[model samples]
Target chain A: MMRLLKIVLLVCLFFGCDKKAERPSAFLQTQQIKLAPPRVLTTSTIIDSSIVLSADFKMEDVKLRYTFDGTDPTENALSYKNPIQITEAGTYSFKAFHPEWTPSETTTVKIYQKGMDTIAIQLRTKASIKYPGMGAKGLVDHKKASLSFTDAEWIGFDTIAKARIDFGKKVHLEKITMAYLVDTGSWIFPPENVIVYLNKTDSIRVQIPNLKSDTLALADVEIPIEKTVQYLTIHVQNLKELPEWHPGKGLKAWLFMDEWIFN
Target chain B: MSYNRRSFLKQSSLATLGLLSGPFYASAFSSNNNKDVIIGHNSHRYKVDLGWGMLDPSKTPVNDCHEMVQDSKGRIILLTNHIKNNVIVYDKSGKLLETWGTEYPGAHGLTLVKENGTDFLLISDFERNQIIKTTIEGRPVLTMDYPKETGLYTTKNSFRPTETAVSSNGDIYVADGYGEQHIIHYDGKGQLLNVFGGRGEGEEQFLNAHGICFDNRDVHNPSLLITARELNQLKRFTLDGKFIETINVPGALICRPVIHKSEIYFAVLRSKNSSDFDSGFVLIMNEKNEVVSCPGATAPAYQKGELQELYQTVRLFQHPHDVCIDDDENMYVAQWNSGQTYPIKLTRV
Candidate 1:
């Protein structure tokens, strides 16, 4: 019995069972865990004229605060009870707040207002049958596709895609904005270069930059078209081969386009 | 001598108290402590053990840990695409015990079934376009090729099976998820019995039929639960091939359904949105098919009997493919394309 007690005591001491529990450092910042940012439901950033902007967060008693004056949202900002209608263009930001948790990161969405109307559009090259979209009319429909390529709003192409836009008549145009998808995981890449023919003689080219991250996103490429003409032809070159660092290297990359805004 | 004995007893009891109260205090006071990242909601919260199942990469490299299963002996089995070690067996404490198999290059789904008091493993290899059944010791017992009798395919390459489910009577159901989206059923003798579900937008059709499982909770009224991943819904079919109901989990791309006791668990591969790539989480549903908890994501909320859209609130998991629940209610999550990392264990709080 005496030997057993000695063994138990030695085991307890080896395990440091008698050590005093040290308190956490006083220098440690005492703060609540921050909540994740609220979801920005308003996906269409570039609109024709007006849009209904909204955001949602389902946590109980957690309110979504927002500001439309190009400023970060704070506790003093207006609490979002319903969707806000924006007739003018500006930047909108939203943040979720709760009494017990720290405020979430600010989510920003920039809304562009200027959109030139187009009478008709004709496609020279057809999109892939898998991603048929709503046909060529989807380009001028003013409906932007979310970052997801499977939303049917995007017209995907494995080859160079060309589209010809015809305005009602010759009008003053300063620039042409085109929106495309960038999801590297799905092998969808931005166009290599976008060529916009203002007319049969003069044209401008915009080269897409190489992506630095593997994140999925939507990008808008603007081409400077100072000359005004009734007809505009656009040639979007698909990335012929994926980068060497990509898993699907040496394979043809896909090109997804959602909308084209003529300004 | 009597006083010394009493004093020794007192010291020993105090040491025991200190050791027992340490973990209890750490968890009880975790709300105010930022050291532990507790996830999930309601009565299903858990803390992640990232270091669990981590092995020496130089010895046993993994490409994508696709699925996991716990055997009757309480041993955890993981299936990865890496041919060097396709299946790695580990203890509940994440100690590597054994490794085997080099032929399952596209190892995706793993299901364990007990028959005649012997445990068998069903491995779905999409790359090889077949379902291979083997003993627990890595010996092949049977091999099921493409369902040629279904007349749904013109070539073997078109029948990429992703998941499988076994009925109580040994009937096998294969979900050709990456193929033409059909569920092929066969008897225990490997004879094709029936086939249903094709790619369409109808109620009985499935888009990306990624996973399938037998729902034997109600023994008399067992059904099959299949996942239409792209549509973000779980479709239930009667024993034969009749559509019952669709459980909508909006904004969550669930990979598979793992039923444990009275609840169903799923590894949400990613959020339904296009922007967030690594927004994956684990979802739990009660017996009534209502989402009760979502770990690494937002709390489950419903309005007017319809579940609101669910998204990732915390970036904990990246493309989690499967979930394995042990007898102790702990969960092991296997991921796909997540930097080739090992399975992460979530200990119940």
Candidate 2:
């Protein structure tokens, strides 16, 4: 009887002790957990004079804070009460925080300066019917598409995308910047090469770099033209065939263009 | 000798105290003291048990644990695309009961049906382009191929069915989600009766008809809830395939609808868009189709009767494809493209 009682006691003792410690709940582990980043909503990241930047988070009692000096936002940062008016070209980061919750990841938005205005634009190639975007004017509409191609801001092309832009008057520009999406998973690739003609004479060819990752990324192809011009004609060569490393190797690659900035 | 006996009694009492003081025993008996992570919002919060369904990968490997269902015997059944062990059966406590099926390579959907007395399972295999009805013990009973009589399908490949819903009268409704986006209706005898909802932008059509379920909440007015995943909308249709209304859940790529009691739950496959990979959560709605809670994501909010765009607020889930609720009001979430992991169990808090 004593032996049996001892065995029961041992078993009870075995079941009593917890191998794991009584750690704090993960939800309560503020130092180790970070909330998802807040969304930075704006008409366009590519701005001319000024742009309205709005930060939003779904959770209540959460304050959205931001910084424009390329630093992570903290509780002491400027709390976002309304949409911020950005008049300069720089990087802006936003973070969401609550007293009872961990701070959110930082959301970064890059602003590019483009002051030249296009009075008229013409599409020389047909855009894909599925992603026609806002038409020819969308390229110069000062509106930029997100990294997502389905946002309907990007105009896709299976064939070569050619366009001509008229500034209406001569404007000195340092360079021409064109932005495109490179989402290999969606079969969207950067153009093979972009040829730009200034005033139908001075020309330069910008070759896109070969991407090594399959992640979604944006490419800004810049053509250096340090002269004044009124009319700009450009031809963006589509990737004729997907690279051998891609799953759709031998198939045609799609070219997605969202905005063109003349600076 | 009297002193020794008294000392013995004292030791026994101390042992008992020690047992009661154990943190493990305390937590096991009183859930109030459980230190597990608690998530969700409103009256639908849950305690996450991330290791509830975890198993030895070498023994019972799973890839893309697609869907799950609870049997009449209170057993949880999980379906995966991994052909090695396509079906895994587990008890309510997450104990391994059995594993079966090596033929369903693309087993994407699992539905449990109780007929007369016995429980049966409906498995939708998109890669095989067929739907197989099997016994709970893994015996194949009925096999259905593409609805060739519908004339909408050019070939068998064009009938990639993703989900199936059975009415009380034994009628089967198949959602050809990845195919031509049509809903094929058939009688109990496997004969095609009617077809509706093809690929279109109209209210009667679907972009990605990923899931379907019989909503008998209104007994006299039974309807079907279908998922238009790409559009982030849950469409309701009458029994005969007439558009009733739409419940919009914008920004969530919902997989299927699982109705339990007075609430509807969905495994949001991804958030924002399909390309935003590894962003998923579990969404729950009340009887009025209002989102009450979203575990692993933002709290549900409404502006002018329209649900605000929802996204993941935490990385708790990655591509949650289906949710199965048991009799205990607990949830089991199966995932797709999540590193060959097992289902996650969420116990009601």
Candidate 3:
């Protein structure tokens, strides 16, 4: 106890004598304690093939550790040396650490592959520049849709978006699926209805109900396609007006969606 | 001594301005002198002058240089919390004209008003929980204690006033930004006329109501412009404290509203969602209420008529608390927590 007291006194004296011109403030202290997670950069498209995954951090001295088994990355996890070669698809999550900084926010990526082959698609209207959804080719890129509307893979539309896929030749398809992000705070809402034209005359449709919460969520809609067709078109509608609780109340809502997978 | 007091300072010991040896006189100008010499965007660009108002710290030191105002004579008045000189006056050329006052320990807000051809200053001290009206030369003329008549405060400390504004009718409106976020109005005689607003998220309430100023631009319907710093919003109210409108400038933690012809100029203390180090800039808006330029930050970008979040693009300023624009359109920026440095001048280009 005497030795500990002496050590504490010495530390206080040392710090007291060192008249540094600049010192850490209360705001910096709080920020250092609030650990920020790291970023896991991976494309949403998944093909039945190997992929590469990497981590991005703001600071150079930060050390990254990652895991691929759907578990949170710990400091003891495998130290990130280079981009991981992801041959097996799963969840890739990572965290960053520094000696003087707090741990970074945890980030994860989903690895998915295209379920089908030999398909050409075209979008009628160009995507919004802010959220281009990584271009129309991203729909059939075999990548899964992400929940974050800000993701480069999510295509944003001002009012509505229509996509038509040409198989070139007649093909057999069973399931049609697409992912959407629902974040009401940013004026992004789920589509009011999703309609698919199997041919020209006959069509099937699915409606998304009104959302009550402001939390960001992902909605993946899947429709079973038992008929064989040469061309398939998708019509996703945007919300006309936002709810009353939001700041942009009664304003036109934004529509954000990721890749459309046809299996 | 050479004009560069900084060079002389480097060769001396910790002694000057009745101040002891301390780290407060740490380097002020950033190392990248060339890049930081010029900043701003669009037609409102400015030539940065970091060397302006450089004083010998041992003689006239400052802590948290909060607010600045230009008088009719074109002289600049700076308010600081340093006990040695709560008020420092300067000329357009950054020459020290005078310094006075040891009463204001937490001198946070300074508002200059001309009444009957005489200029007076409203000094708000949060530490003393009072607003003192004094002549430009630092003679205390009137003292206003906590507003017990408002029934919002039980003690003086609970009424820490941050800003005060004088109307065209000579009515003094005090905004207790640090304490209750209440706007207390009183006749020039210091009798409480009325009180409105409190702490809340509603349009009528405020969080960190840091500033208040009278908008006489609309001669027919003058109003008060107040700041809600935490929400990055400026709430305008009628002379009687009626809510008029809320102008939202996202990512900008504004200090006070300094109005010029066809434009409103103010210092953005810092930007929200930015690293907490001194991410500040000067924001200017046209008469149409559209942000025209952001000096020391990236040019303002809007999407679908909505302004995007703004962050620091140039490291010219650190926590700029107030901006005083001269008749020539030049700007003087007073900073907070910026190494006890003096005000920086931005010459309009």
DockQ of each: 0.09, 0.09, 0.02
Q: If both were scored by TM-score, which would come out higher, candidate 1 or candidate 2?
A: 2
Stretches of model 2 off by over 4 angstroms after superposition: A1-33, A74-76, A98-103, A118-138, A146-153, A159-171, A192-207, A217-219, A223-237, A240-245, B1-36, B273-275
- What would the per-residue lDDT of candidate 1 be over residues B1-349, giving only the tens digit for each residue? 0101001111122221122322322322233433455778998988776657777788987878899999989999999999999999999998999999999998998999899989999999989999999999999899999988788788889998889999999999999988889999998767899999999768888888999999999999999999999899999999798999999999999998999998999999877752445568899999998999999788998999999889876445667899999999999999876666788789898
Give the least accurate 10-residue stretch of model 2 chain B, judged by summed lDDT.
Answer: B1-10
Docking class of 3: incorrect
Model 1: per-residue lDDT, tens digit, A12-125? Answer: 334433235333221111122345567787746766567788887766668899998988898899999998888877778998876544566677776776577655899999
Clashing pairs in 1: none
Ranking by lDDT: 2, 1, 3
Residue A26, model 1, lDDT: 17
User: What TM value does model 2 have?
Assistant: 0.82
Task: Give the lowest summed-lDDT range of ten residues in model 3 chain A.
Answer: A24-33
Alpha-carbon TM-score of each model against the true structure: 0.80, 0.82, 0.56
Candidate 1 vs. truth: CA RMSD? 12.5
Candidate 1 chain B: worst-modelled 10 consecutive residues by lDDT: B1-10
lDDT of 3 by residue, B251-270 (tens): 89889888887688879987
TM-score ranking, best first: 2, 1, 3
| Best prediction by TM-score | 2
